[model samples]
Target: MSRIIRNLVSLALLLTAMSVQAAPSSFDLVGPRLSVAVTRDGSTLPLEWVPNLAEGDRVAIKLDLPAGQSDRFRLVAAFLRGAVDRPPDAWFHDTVSGKTKGGDLSLVVPKGAQQLVLFVLPERGAGRNAIVSAVRKQPGTFVRAVQDLNQAALDRARLDTFLDLLFRIGRQDPDSVNAASQVLTRSLAIKLKTECLQQPPELQAACLTGDRETLLFADTHSSALADTLTGAPVDLAFQLSATPQGGYGSYSSYIGVVRDILRLFGAFQSSQLRFVPALARMGDGRLTLLLNTPLSFAKPASVMVVGLPAIEAAKPPPLQAAAGVPLLCAAPDTVLPVEGAPLVYATRYAHDMVLRVAPDGAAGFDLPVHADARRGGFVLDRALPDRSAGATIDARIAGRWGFTPFDGPRFKLSDPRVNRWTAAPRASLVVGRSNAVTLTGEGAGCIDGITMQRGDAAAQAVSWKQDDANTIVVDVPLDKATPGTVTLTVTARAPAPPVSIVLPALQEVGRIDGVAYAAGDESAVLTGSRLDQVREVRAGKATWRPGALTRAAGADRLTLLPVDPAAAQVLTAGERIVADVTF
Candidate 1:
């Protein structure tokens, strides 16, 4: 053979080998059928029907090898404790040499092992280190393989149940169809549009069977659905209409239509069911986890957020999962009762929602939170100091299928700091009207105390609400006020001095007695008692404020522009437009 021919042959062989390696693994072809059985109350029973197993349970691994492949292959079992990167030998592992066809191998589940991974490799290089190294090199591959297997197994059970219901309906059982209706409604976490449900009783069913089915089903090729399913949950802005269609005709046909629709939904579920986690910063500075999962058909009964530290990084500061506490700033009084770190939330059938966690003050955690393989539980982390800043923490999201490493958002260790408060009084004290006062500054949303008083008398009644991040609106009722100077004081989240504003007697406040406007003129004149106190005036829908003021004989005069000309025209049309005068 010539040298050139040999080189060509070698290049062809190299490409073939590369292609083989790059080809994706088919979960079915690499067949080593396995089943788990747990020992409960001294009786070892097969758990083929069980969807999940808890940590620290003693289990037997039943394996069945592929045809003509046995003695050369060995099964390596990795009981995963947490979604953290570790050395090949750092994780717990057990092996069963494929000496015989396939037999039961017994092993105890380690504490905190959220999942178990099995690798069937050739015995020659299948040492513990080699197997772990191969598993670690492609962690996502190993995890996803098991995750897919679990999801498929779950889907199989669901398919069987659905098929059984369909078979009963075929047997002329009308009640079976009604029973399946509830199941079909819960098949997807996404909600139907309000319009679809708002139809009259007779048209309700027709509405769902109409072209409006897209309101509930998103388009299979929609980029929005693809994007939403790929990453953390985002605020869905577009309408959903993918993948499922509304079935027309008889009510029984609707059942078959839903069955087909659910089939498509299941395929979507299999493709997009990612158990990864994403972090979001809530409005009030609280960090939240948005786990990307909850299959359209099989939503999780509960979710857990596990905090794990980096293997090589500095020791993580103490942290806590504030379970059952409401993030007042972000969600206000919505009490989210979570378990602990991994903070477990009993969220059944929730496709995506914000989960808030806080550190526990009492019985805090330590570094290196892990799922214990032997002890059968988790070792959580501790709470950081109140002033701790720039501290980093790692997190993972765990569901029924499995857990995945998640990158959490950076958060501050303390509440928002307020430097000062500035008050912009929007209204004056009128004897029989409500006054609005606007306060703007840092920590404006944290107003807990506010009061109004006349001289040194008792505090007057006032109500205030945070309008935004740096603004607050306070309503002061002057229905029972006597003529006197009223002082307003506000206390907020910050420990600074209380901000105060003073107002003159209610009788001294200005009033708009009459508003004068000329046809086609841009400005309007207001004549009223104490006109100097009047800051703004409204004629119909148009707002007019004094720009230049002049005092005439026994009267105060001001030039004001009608900001809206169209509304000013309504005034010229003799519309009974009310004049609103405010300080």
Candidate 2:
């Protein structure tokens, strides 16, 4: 009996081990409890608990199994809509529809399924220990499913009918018809063409009429056709009539009637539909009727029936005679004359006006007044006047009537002529037999004294003595003047061009006073007479240098020093320092 008990206990233990190794049996799973937690290592697993699911909800199942070697075990998480009793080891495996995480498995609960059963297991001849979990449907999924059903139903027959009407209207014009037909054919080829039979009859009729009632349906239902017909009802209608005729009137009459209908319909339609505004003019007067809306959508058939009224011309302002100005005889009446004044009168007839200026000192057909004159009479209806100064005459009067003062005679100033200079060149002089300087205008003039400092001064100033009317002569002396630069300035109303003088270099005769000596010598005295020939001492010598010496007696003596004993000496003690200098 003890042996028998041992056998039974061992058997029970074996059964318990088998139960632990077995996968859970197929069971119904739903949402709200279904969830996946992704780990930092990119491994994902479904929750341990099953969820309450609704129809159309998705469930993601994951299994945490080793990668690469995972293919050795074919694992699947199967969800059945109904309950089933099956062995855990006998669970079936299904190929996952998407990416798997280490033998992961997922299954969606179908819309028609009332319950779901999930199985996690390996394929035939596979290893074990692959854990699978899944997500289940929730209330939000059911709500979305209902919404989708309603939207699908909403996108039906009515929309198709509206698009059909649009297609019909876009076929009237040859070019538009061809273009739309091509598009339709291409769409049909692509299997994207919509069927008119799917649309409701009421929406179809509204689309045919191009009525506003169909707009909302068109917008939501047929984006392309809706965009085409946004503002283009007239054109759309014409296109529809041009299509192969089966319904409505004959082709020619159909066109005429549609044209007439468009015209009549346009009257009620907003101005925004018409492309061009109406314009009218009478006798050069312009009338513009500004339509407030842009007509990018529709174009009118013709402007003749629109009937734009011609605009009347604006009347010109009434003519007012200038104060104290004469009013010459006008065509219809005799006007009184204002003494010592010019007259101007303005009149208007219809779109035309005339401005009349009476003859003051001259008579002419037409003349323009000076633009600068504030009070002059102007003929706005005629050409501008000549600005040149001249005598004006009325030939009928046989005498010159208008004369511009200072027009023909010459005037002279009583002041003496003065020469002006500005920015004159160095060594320039205004007086002393220089070139004649022309004076521009009459003004008080001043003369600036000549300045001398530069070596090029050869010009000198002398007294200005007037000789005759518009003529003056100035005597200048350049002899005995320092050979340097000088400038003369004269101020007057207007200046003449400047005169410049360049002096030749003067050859100076200079004297030297010594024979060459060592450069270190402090002083070497020299005696010489006739040293006035020296323009500079110790010039043109290689090393002889002149030095200041304090002389107690006789002529002031010049000491000399030499840079080297080889330098030439032209003077000796007691000999005159005779130096020929060219000045």
Candidate 3:
């Protein structure tokens, strides 16, 4: 029996050497560059060759399973480090028969292992399993495995894939058992407090029972106690309880309960959630939520009741309104500085007066009642001297003053009289009834001279012509004098390039005395120094008859007159100046 054992051991050693010698080259040992093929069952398994792996090298074996299969399958890989005794870094259960599902799986191998083993299983049952086997390579096989797996990691490696998928599925199909489990895990992990958990039987239900009322209370009173709570701006107004498919109240109420619970739980985790269920107002009116505890770590206990007055009702009015006062005067006037103590009359009486007076004695008053009186009916009873009486009686009676008096009895003391008595200069030019024949110079400058029309036909009319240097003068008919003021406009030419006229800053010259003046239906007089040399006296384009021009031969003035009366009558309104001057 001893001899047989020795021979068997030698045979085993020979077979082991042959197997090692039969190992493929580094290129062949590392199979297909660790290509990952995702199976129809959603397992992403990597098949790679371990090159030159010695009998005692420690290595990590990574088996990547599809997103939802990591927790369900058992990962088994041979020739790996820390495989037999579970290592802290190992992501999969080493003793499990199949691989984990719901995420990617990884395992470490113990030394002296020859082949790698991997097993993948479905999430729920034990039947479906994907098996992967890989050969161990010599010399830095562990590092190579890690490198190859790192590249393949993207194929099945996602940190929150399972969680996100769980959420998506749960939202879509809340009744799914897998989705429920996922949601429960997520909720528990995040420590979310749901309204579903807070309700007590049917009576305590968030949506069905009066939980919605409680939520509304929290929202309306959020501003009052927001500072004291951990979370604020809680959007409790949205009908979160109602699902799209469910009836209005049913869906919103249900979702609202869940959302509220989540908010509360979020607050609890962040140390911010404050539940001070008091009273709050809705569009319909008020509601109350009874918060069981002042502050507690354990789940909150609360109840809701409709038609409760908000906490704001218990507090006094806001501080801003405290300063407001009701005023009581109608048509109040500001007190002004006067030489004498003038008795001013009020337009209407006030039961109580509230005045906001400025430093300058300008006062604004609020009226207690509407005034029903008309204007100018109430007058001030004050005496004035004959000289002081010249001061115009102009008064700003505050209560809707109009031109006409009111039909009611006049209040003599109600209207205030303002005295303005200052002498002003009389106008040089008056609008009505003047006997003097006024002739306005048209065109540029002031009128210098005037001449009377001479000839056989001129005796029939009273005609006095004015001489405006290089301009026309308006000839106002003295015999048939008009009552109103007649405006005579002259063509005021802008000065030549070298000459600029500086207009008087204080006084506006209404009409230029000379140049070319045109009045209604009367002959205009054009007079200048070189009147006879002017070939064409054109206003705009049409020619004008030359008016009498005084040609002085050594201080002897000779008047050259217009021979045509028809040409003089052609000059009409606006600036009538001679254009295209020849001389």
Best-matching candidate per TM-score: 1
Candidate 1 structure quality by residue, lDDT tens digits, 1-583: 6999999999999999998765422112112345555564464434431224555456676545556764544455676544454423545455554554444567666555566654444455335565565556555444433443333322222222333433444356443343332333223212233453454444443443333222222222333543344322222211211211111000110112222222332332222121221111111112122222331222311111111111111111112333322222211231222211111111111111222234434332222333221121223333333442221122222222111112222122212233246665644565544567676665553356788887778986588876655566778777566777778887654444577778765665455557777777878888755665677887657888776766556355767776676777666645466777787
Instruction: Score residue 171 of candidate 3 by CA lDDT.
Output: 50
Each prediction's TM-score versus the true structure: 0.32, 0.13, 0.15
**Pairwise TM-score winner, candidates 1 and 3:** 1
Q: Highest lDDT: which candidate?
A: 1
Candidate 2 accuracy as TM-score = 0.13
| Error of model 1, residue 574, in angstroms | 22
Winner by lDDT between candidate 2 and candidate 1:
1
Global lDDT of model 2: 0.28
lDDT of each: 0.41, 0.28, 0.26
Candidate 3, 92-196: lDDT as tens digits: 233332333323333333333333323222233222111111112121332233222221121111112223443454456544533243232222111122443
Q: Name the 10 consecutive residues with the lowest summed lDDT in model 2.
A: 397-406
Which portions of model 1 miss their true places by more than 4 Å? 1-384, 388-404, 408-433, 448-461, 487-583
Off by over 4 Å in 2: 1-50, 66-71, 83-93, 96-103, 126-583
